[model samples]
Target: MDPVKRHLPPLKTSINKYNLHAKKSLGQHFLLDPMINQQIIALAGDIKNKTLVEVGPGPGGLTRALLDSPARCVIGVEVDQRALLLLNELKEYYPERFKIVEHDALKLDLTTLCDSPRQIISNLPYNIGTTLFLGWLKQGAAWDRMTLMFQQEVAERICAAPNTEFYGRLSVIAQWVANCAIVKRIPPGAFSPPPKVYSAVVNVVPKSEQPSPILFKAMETVTAAAFGQRRKMLKGALKTIDGVNLLAKANIDGTRRAETLNISEFDQLARLYAQNNNL
Candidate 1:
């Protein structure tokens, strides 16, 4: 039997019984659109034999979609007590495939959660979306891929190119170690209690070997300083980093703003900083 069709009854009943109202404090927004739910699942691609780790499975909407997929196992880390109750019922219906951990996703150690060749698929809480992505990236080749939903603006920043308004610390950091692409755009209405802004689904596949840690650290420091005062020129903004000598070391036009630099330019600046610090 199709898992979605078989488990639909329990999902509906659990929702009602638990009074699983979306909590604003948790940045909860249940996705009620079945089509969108299935679409996001499809984006996960070739789930067969793959393990999936999902965050914030509010009302088990996306959880249902994952259950219906060919995935070997679906583990959800949910913080909401009401949603956790509903998730427990789903576990009962699909004992072999469903597992719910009642804990904050942000605090969980993803490296210890599942073995390699896993994937993270979630409509993440907006408040912690970027923080979670950064954490996953720092894990250094932990998962096979990440299919995530973020605010449209954040989605653009992840996939943004050089010199674009959306390009900044996020673009540099994400591009340094992974290939990012916006798979699809979902309208605001697709979500229950639709968010004021549109949302987008993004796919991220990490690189085989990431750039030097020293370079990453330098890039973080440089971008933080540059974008922190985005209006200022690169030379002025980067002066805070010792031994930077921005223009002479990076060969970048000092007159240009931070947004004007491409990934390569940032890489050059990072390399320069690292060399200066012997990092």
Candidate 2:
């Protein structure tokens, strides 16, 4: 057995001993499957000397896997006070390497806490997964890569293609600045308090070269107006933003709906929108 495992009890044992049942209010579906946990960590690529930042690590199932790996350290952002107590016990096994911050992942600026050559791997709290992901993408190469878990439906939306049913503002914005792919699918049963929907892990690597903040903000605005009324053509859906004029400037067909437009087209539209509005 690894020396660390000898010191720290398994995650299930710790959970039962602490009576830390999953909390629905916190979206706490504990990842009890060790195999799944290890697999998710593997998707982050090598962590030999890399920092691993895990979010919402309730009961520390995935946290244990990260400790066992050759990672230089594991920094867990946990909101549940009960989970932090359990995680605190891990400090004994890896006194210098494991640290827990009792803070809400959403409110914390994760990038500022660690240095580069880091990777974030987590079975995220379902309620805030997408919002956190969008925030992370905006960090502009703060970390090397991100391997995150989300609902199966959300996973498809992240990696969806143009004209597909799953494609929308999320697909456009996510793909614009990052290379996203579905790493694996995890059934609902994998989680201790299984979520109603199946889960899937996604790998997101942000592009080293990204558009300026103004262009990105413009993209966000354009996608919101475009996909806000997805069924309507560009002319009617984008009327508030001068949709027909914007489309003509971008050399795109005004008859097309938001779902039919690709990321490149959206990028062009955002640039034109910014220029037109002098934004």
Candidate 3:
């Protein structure tokens, strides 16, 4: 059957049959619109014959989208018991093409979730989405691509530019390692029990030249210090931080605020800090 034309039960009906309700504490918001889900999957570019990992496959709404794609297989990491039976039904439907790992996505190493050459695609749990992405950014380039959904504000921070209100540690680190962009802005109505805020799908591809885990940590340290006092001048913000002296050493202006510095400049700071501290 053609992926686009494949016959599958409606996601809403499955949710009803499984006695599933979106958990407020878990930050669950099912993207129950089939076409919207399909569009989200397409943002990953191409998966043909590769495995796709989904972080929170609530109600299998987006799971259906992944299965309907030409991807060779889909592995969903889920913690909700309410979703297991419904996902099991999906597994039966796509016996050769689907698998489910019953566990908390945040507790497991995503790289170990499957073999190499995998790509991650999911409507991530809003609460842990940033935390998970930060981990993925630190890990080796285990996956080819990652297409994820995050709260619109989170998405903005991930893709925000220097000097913008949304830009912070997230913008610097994510931009340092990968090409980040928000490909779609989704309305609240797109989800079941719609959230108060809108959502967006982000596409991130790792750069060929990337930071080592140690260097990445250095960057994290500096950004935390710099943005921790975001409104203060760089000299004041980083005075107690190791990277402060590097401003004069690297010819960076001490009068500028943290948000005024770009990714490359932050890299310079991280590198300088790492070298001096013998990290």
Question: What digit string (tens of lDDT, one per residue) describes model 1 on residues 1-279?
Answer: 766476457555677899987788888778877788898988877788889999989898888889888898999998888887788877877889898888887888876877867999999999999999988888657888899999999999999998887998999889888999999998888877789999999999888987666667887887898788888887788778852486676677788888988877887888877777788
Q: Say which prediction, candidate 2 or candidate 3, comes out ahead on TM-score.
A: 2
List the pairs of residues colliding in candidate 3.
none
Misplaced by over 4 Å in model 1 are: 2-4, 7-10
Candidate lDDT values, in order: 0.84, 0.88, 0.88
Task: Residues 1-279, candidate 3: write the lDDT tens digits.
Answer: 755335667777788999899888999988888888888888899899888999989798888878878898899999999898889988877888898999988789978867877999989988899999999888737878999999999999999998788999999999999999999999998887899999999999998887888899999999999999888988988887745578987789999998999998999999998988899
- Write model 2 residue lDDT over 99-135, tens digit each, in one string: 8888888898998878987889998988899999988
Q: Regarding TM-score, does 1 or 3 come out ahead?
A: 3
Compared to the true structure, candidate 2 yields what TM-score?
0.97
TM-score of each: 0.94, 0.97, 0.96
Instruction: List the RMSD of every prediction in angstroms.
Output: 1.8, 1.1, 1.8
List candidate 2 stretches off by more than 4 Å: none
Error of 1 at 90 (Å): 0.3
- Tell me, by TM-score, which candidate is best: 2
